[model samples]
Every structure is written in structure tokens, then in C-alpha cells.
Target: MKKILNPCFLAGIIAVFSLTACRDDKMEETTPDQVQTANAKPEQPNPSEKSCSYVDSNWSWSAVLINTLPTTTDTNFMNSQMVNIAKMWGKSTPTLLFVNDPVSPGSTYNAASYKTGYRIYYGYAIYNDAKAKGGDIVNAMILAHEYGHQLQYAYNLPTVKENTGRSIDLEADGFAGYYLRRPNGYNKTDFSQIAAAYEFAQSIGDYQTTNPGHHGTPAQRRSAVRLGFLIGQYDVTAKDFDTTFFAYYNGVLDGSLKMVDNTIRPEIKAYLDQYVDELKKIQSGEISAEEFKNLK
Candidate 1:
């Protein structure tokens, strides 16, 4: 059955997750020579020792995945992207820990294990499904989406006030969309590939009404992705990106009062022009409410 999440509870859930499970204050960078055991939960590193993982491999995101995507080629691209994105928020070398559970209990698509940098399980099984349905381009979208969360950590973006189901989840989805449209990494100028990934990710947000902590409903999730995509059509620094992101996001969660039509940021405005019509169509319900479901 479809689930509808109250915005407030979703905000609380974010806080609760932070307070109970997340260890943001404790995360430290890994050093080059330090070969810590994969599962060994180490204390947060000191200032000089912070290191980002630079895995090298044929494995798509094995560089970021703790043990699952192990490969020989250094995956500095992930580290580079994280570093570049984090710099905007004044963070350096945030630890990227990996959890090995095939089916991580709490949330899927990986989340920060508290303030300890970023935790990405990248479960092969999960990626397999995403690949089968969405393809590699779509998978790239997913990776970028998860990295967006890392940006949130480095910058200390305001946690949602209410832990309801919709706001936080949608915001993250929006963030993912925002990055996909950027030129640096994926360089996806068009929305088609990103949209498919967005839809694929949202479909897994299936839960009954009783699952209070479930992600947003399918419609809300789609809106979030569309919003992100709309924002992506323009170029902005990480600083500008976060500021605009939170402003628009808070506006979306609070009410319709946060509408923005200004193209004053000439560059952003120019980029957004490409997506204006598509955004309007989405806002107008041009897209069907299709969802992807996890096979039993």
C-alpha cells in the first residue's frame, strides 16, 4: 500500500537518527598508511590524520563501498568530488566508512552513521536491482545523489525541524537532481537519464502508512527530484548551491509562500530556462505517477 508521511515527523526522524545513531562529532579522516580493519569501529580521527578513501577498481563505486566494491584502481574521483563539494561548506577529508550488511536495517542507499563523515554500504543486491531497471547512467545518478548527503554533513545544513516522512527525503532527492544537472561530474545536460533514476529510487520508498519513518510518498519524492533537476539546469558554486537549496527546500516544506521566479543570478537563470517548461509540466501533473517496486 502507498504511504503518506507527515512533514513534521520526518524532521523529527532526522533528529532522532542523528541523536541516536549518527555520530557526526566523532568522525575523523583516515591516514594513508593506516590499514584499519574494515569492521573495526575506530574512534574519530584527529585533525591531521583525516583521509578520504581512494579506491581503484573496475567496481563501479567499489572505491566508496567499504568492502563490496573493492577494486585496484584508486577511486579518487569519488574523493575528489567529495572534497570539492565539501570545500564549499568548510570540511576536509570527511571519513567515508562502509557498513557491510547486505540488507542494512535502518535506511537504504546509505546514510551518514551519525557525524562520522559518510557511510555508504552500496549493497550489491540493491545496485543490481537499480542497474536492471535504470542502467549505468541511472546508477551514476544514484551515486551522485548519495554524495549530496555527504555535502550536507560537511556543511552542517540545518536538520529538518519535523522528522516527518516527506520533507527530508524529498530534499535529498532534490539534491540528487541538482547535482545530476551540473556540468562537472555527470555533465548530464538533459533530464531524461536523471528522471529515470529519480523514479527508480523513489519506488523503493514503498511502505504502509504505519511505517512512520518511511521515505516520502511517490508523488512527493518525484517533486523533490524534479525540483533538484530544475535547480541543476544552472551552475552555482557549492556555497551558492547549498544556500539556494535550503532556501527553496524550506520554502517547499513550510508552504507555497517560498515561490521563486527571479532569474537575477543570470547564469543560474539562463540554465534554468532549459528546464522551465519541464518543471511546469511536472508541477502541472504532466508526468504519470508510476513507481518501481522491490521484487519479492
Candidate 2:
């Protein structure tokens, strides 16, 4: 299980802003040593013995994931989330890769591969700060989200528009949302904390939705995550996922999406109906400032 640690805490926190600028697409070529080490996927540790190990060094950035969260009991919650998602798709674990990219440290997530398996480099700085802030839900969500990209790499799921980058990212967000709400996740925790973490993560959504690599507009991302959670709440399966994902996610982006009211799938919509009102409240800003502050 992942362990929790004290992060590089910062004070006077403001609402987290999503970094939205699009940079040049040029990628640095991977070195031979990196190619060899990053290509190897470690054996999946027994869940009971999984824990986070911190390796401190001089660098511009880093991603430090703890085994446990102070606010929840989901041990190694990050690893567990990715493993569960892989099982759902009938795939093996991808190597968890870390690197320092001066080009776009703000743009931390990317999936790479080798002959054996895949690897993921999480932006160290952003991830570290998030972890310090008790962003366990967000941390697990980010891991699963990146793994969703690994899924795209494996299955070559049709992208929204290949060069535009919207379809791939939106789908990945959908994938992350898909697992976050599952019973297998940060289990035995309160929904309020989940919501808090979800919001914390959302605060990082980029404002420039038009950028080719822009993940999604903030609102679109929020909807994507909510959609993912809704699926898990209703026990939706992967085999029948695409049809449902496209219809629901499109409505969300176009501003035509309403909680459970406009959902086209009867059975799944029925399962999510209870949260419709609460969701609408969040979307509409009905919750008071004091109320939101009490969440953690």
C-alpha cells in the first residue's frame, strides 16, 4: 500500500489554477539507460505489503506518493486504482516511470513504452505539492488518468481528433472518472472527502481548451470525472463502455448535459439519479463558502 508523507507544505493557498498554455510538440529522445530501466515493469506487489518509498535528490521537480493518506484508509490507493483499471481492461500493469522535463514541468504526465511494457512520468513538482496537501483522491485519480493513456497506447482507442488531442485526453479523463467512483477505490472513505479531492484536482484544469494538447476545459474535466464516478456507482462494464461514454461525455461538453435528467441510458441513469440534485448544486454554485471549507 502507498504511504502518506509530509509534503513541501506551502501556506496561504489560493484556488489552484490549471496550467493551460500549449508548448511546442517536440519531445526529447529517450537515452539508452532510461530506455532500458523505464521499459521494465515491476511485478505487482501483494496489496498487503505495498508501500511508498521516497528518494530525495537535487532536481527541478519530483512526484512523491505516500502509501497511506491521513484522511483515508485506502493503502497504496494509487497503485490499487491503476491495477483495478488494468484488470477491468484485461491488461497487465504498466511501468511507473518518473522523469524531469524542464521543457514543460507543468505538463508532467506522459506514457511511453518498450518491448516489454509501458512507463509513466508524472510531473514531480505538481504531484509533490498535491500530495503535501492531502490530495490522495486527486493523486489516485491522476495515476489512473495517466494509465488511461497507457490504455489508449495498447488498444489504440480512436481519438477525438488525432492532431487536436481533445479526444484522447477527454477519453482519459473519462477513464479516470470511471475508476475513481468504483467500490475498489479509496474505499471506506466519505464521499465529501472524495468530492474535496476531486475539486482540488479540477482546480488545475487549463483554461485554454483550444490548445491541441489541452486536456479539457475545466468544466469538461469536471463532467468527465463525474461521468466516471457515475459509471462505477452503477457498475458499468468496459465491454459496453464506448457507446455510453460518447453520448454522455458529448452532452457534458456541449452544455446540454444535466445530471441524470438528460442521460440516455435508462438503467445506468437510474443508478445515478440520486446524485443528480447534489451534482447540480455543485455545478450551479449553490454550496456556500463556509460549507466547502468544512469538507476536509
Candidate 3:
């Protein structure tokens, strides 16, 4: 919910972009402290007090979510996988609200988390779009991502610094990657599914790097998820996880660390090195969604 400077002025330019209030900045995404107080709209009444509601009356926005997750035999993951996501992080389940705004179903094309309100909301339209793309895996990734913000609020986790929300969003994407691969989590041993989840992450990415709510470019988001899956190979305390994440992530973004750096441990660099080439391919846009799914 970071402030959109001029809705009327940018309305035309925003057709291809989302800007979901909290996550992407349209009707969702900002942390509580970052809510748009000036542009705030009164909460809209809905069928159930607990169901997700779209209240941004004055702002009409939308984004197409193109999911590239590999197919799964269990296509009903969206119905049962959310609770397991919370379990993976050892956090209490938050209230789950499905937003099927009768008045404007298309307007509910966003997903978000309320840290203080202790809930997560998924827009039914967005969920349906995801379901159509790759069944429930896409939606499961979304739920895991919103849950990542919950972990952030609970532990007051440190995030990579950026002027926009990209850092937190990318970190959330990373956490989703970890969940996708964890044996006790999604239990996906195959990198194809791990890659599948990242493709889902890519759908939410935007090119608005300077926008206050920019998540990340598609490639960067995929890289973040890939890094998280790599980390999932071992179990580490949250603090160590944070430490380890930044150690490599900073290098991934800025290329500050070299192959022979002392900061990265031998075992880690060795393990991570195996994927460096593919990661570079992603960042350079050499890989496509179809390619991502079929990769060995």
C-alpha cells in the first residue's frame, strides 16, 4: 500500500503494470507502517467479515499473472497446501480470506497479508487465473509468499535494503523457494518443481524498479527463489538463514564477491557454484518459461 503519487496522472501508463496496494501496490502489498494513509479508502463491507474485501473504490487496477509452474498430479494443492506452508515456518496459521468481490471480481486481482491484522487474503480471480495456468502449484506459491511476510513481522527479520519494496518481496520469494524444496515442506526433490515455483514468482515481478512498491524484475525474482531452494538443502536457524542469505544475495545482485572470495565458505560456494551458470542464464533472459519447466 505504498502511496501512488498521482493515480489519475499515472492511470494511463499503468495499464501494463499492476501496482497492487501492498505486494505489487494496487489493492495490496505494503507493510503496516507503509500503508497509504493519504490515499486510504474506507473498508468495504462484504458477505463475511472474515472474507477478503476489495475497498480501493477510487482506484481501479489489474495485472495479468502468467504462471509457468510445472504440472503436478495433485492439482488441488491450493485447497490443502496453505496450512502446511505455515507449518514449515513454525508459525500459527493466520486467518485465510478468499476475496470474491461480487461487485468487482476483476478488481480483486491481488493477494496480500496483514501483519497486524493476523490474516492473509487471496483474490479469487487471481487464484482462478493461477489455477488455470498450472493448477494449484501457482496459488500455493502465492500463499507461501504472503506467509513469508508473516515470518518477517513475527521475527522482525532483517531484509535487503532498497528504496522500494523489492528487497522484502524478493526475500519473500526466496522463502517460497525454500518451502518448495523442503522435505518437510513441499517435499519437492526435483529441481524442476523448484524451478516451477520460481516461474510462479516471476509472474508477480515488475519492471518498475524505481516505483516505491516494485517487487523485482522477473529474472531477479526467479534468481531469488533459486537461491532459496539452494539454501533449503540444509536446515539452519533463522538467524543463520538470514546471515547466509545476505552473504550470497548481495553478491548475486551486485557481483561484489568473486569466485575466490574468503567470505563464502568453501562448501557453500562449491555447492552454489554448480548453479551459477543457470542463474546467469535466467538473469540474462536466456531462459524462457517453457525452458524453466523442462530444465533438468
Candidate 4:
């Protein structure tokens, strides 16, 4: 499991503008019927049906089993959603497991993808927490992000110049954004709800730019997803989407592609203005390290 935090809270004037931008997009307003149909709750899976069984003990990737199990309803729902996303990539569905324990201490969320046959292990705490925040769409987004890693495994994508994992992580964020905005996936036409759910993505942003495993900062992460969402405006296959995302993403990393001007998206700028200074402090090691870990 990876230890990650949630997006910073948008407050006061910034919160109003940020929330409104997310809520007021014209695209979201045009598809109320489809949104209702796509997001309708599914019948809970029966617990007696046995949702998951152990596949192998010596698999390339494995973890200690948590004592708790997800309810049949949750397991079935997650599996169904995984199937939907896999179809988007024209690949067979990957195995999904719901774990009870955290991957480590002081972490309420932990999820990992084993490249061997594209397996995913999600902690129950994270699953329940995502559902609580924004219904199943949030849960779907989390699963989609993990599946993004599987796509990397399948395609061997994102040839990175930097040794850090930020490139891979940000690409996965883009993949999730692409799927979330698609009609057959989450069918979330409104960019605002997608932006709101991105709070989860923002929270997981890390300030450890020098760390080999560092993911991008909150602002960078948000920008990546937004780029993906914009690209998703067109109908593109998964491979094509990767090509497009990498073209822009590589530019951002190599200092060739200019970063999107946040002034145009006032709401995003509002949130970033509030957090960027603190993030800089964390990155420079000027503040106590715990502050970065404890970001909420």
C-alpha cells in the first residue's frame, strides 16, 4: 500500500470560486439524464456468493491478508466497475481484492497494483472513505487510477528521464481522468464534480520532489488530471490517450511545455495560491516534516 494524503481544503472566497467553477461547467449541465442513469446505485452483491478467493501464494506480488473482508455488496460493485474500465482499454478485467488492514501505520488509505497479471489490492478503509465522500464515483475514480498502473504494465509506457516515479503516477492520474469523463465509464459530464472528487487526488500529492518515489505536488497533480479531462473531450482509444497525455506531460517535466496558466482558471489558482507556499516550505525542509505527512 502507498501512504498518501487527501487534497487541501478550499476555504472562504477561494472555496466559493473553486466549487462554483466545478459546479458551473456547461458540459455538466447538458447531460442530467445520462448522469442519473450512469450513476444509479446497483443492487448489493450477496455475501454468500463468495466474491473473491485466493489465486496464488507465491505470486509475483502478494501481501499479508487483512483480518477484515469487504461486504459482498462492496466487492461485487467494485468488480463490476473494474469490468467496465477494463472494457474501455479493450483488455480483460484484472483481479481485485479488498483488504482490511492498512499497508502501514498512521495511514488510513493504502492501495497497490501488482504488475503480474495486473492485480489490484485496495484497503477497505480507503474504499469506504471514498464512497463516503462522493458515492461510488469516487470509488470508481480510485479503482481507475490503480488500473492506470496496470495499463503501464501492459504498454510499458512513460519512458521517463527522471528516476522519480512522478511521471508514472501523473500519467496514471491522467488515465483516471480520461475514463472518469467518458460516457461509458463514470459518464461524469460536469467537470466540477470530477474536480470536486479530485480533492482525493490533491490530498495524496507529495512534497518529496527529491525522493525517488515522490508523486507530483498538489497543483501539478490537479493540472495533470485537468489536462486529461480536456483531452477526454475527444473519443480516443487508451493507447492514443497515452500518446496524447505523454506529449504534454513530458513537456511539463522537461521544462519545454509551459505550465497551464492558473489565472485562466481562477478557482484552481485560488486553491494553489493558498497551498503553494506551504508546499514550498515542505519541499525546502523549512517546516517540520510531519506537516507534509499530516496534510489533509
lDDT of each: 0.44, 0.47, 0.59, 0.55
RMSD of each: 11.8, 12.0, 8.9, 15.7
Worst 10 residues of 2 by lDDT: 30-39
Off by over 4 Å in 1: 1-66, 70-114, 158-160, 206-212, 246-257, 260-286, 289-296
| Model 3: per-residue Cα lDDT over 92-168, one tens digit each | 66766444343334444566677556766555555566566766666677778777888877777654577877778
Candidate 3 minimal-lDDT segment of 10 residues: 7-16
Candidate No. with top lDDT: 3
Model 2 CA lDDT for position 232? 61
TM-score, model 1 to reference: 0.56
Candidate 3: regions farther than 4 A off: 1-79, 194-196, 251-269, 287-291
Decreasing TM-score order of the candidates: 3, 4, 2, 1
Q: What is the lDDT of residue 288 in candidate 2?
A: 52
- The deviation in Å at residue 102 for candidate 2 is 11
Q: What is the lDDT of residue 110 in candidate 2?
A: 26
Model 1 agreement with the true structure over 178-201: per-residue lDDT tens digits: 766666546566665565676765
Candidate 3, residue 138: CA error in Å?
A: 0.8
Worst 10 residues of 4 by lDDT: 30-39
How do all models score by TM-score? Answer: 0.56, 0.59, 0.71, 0.63
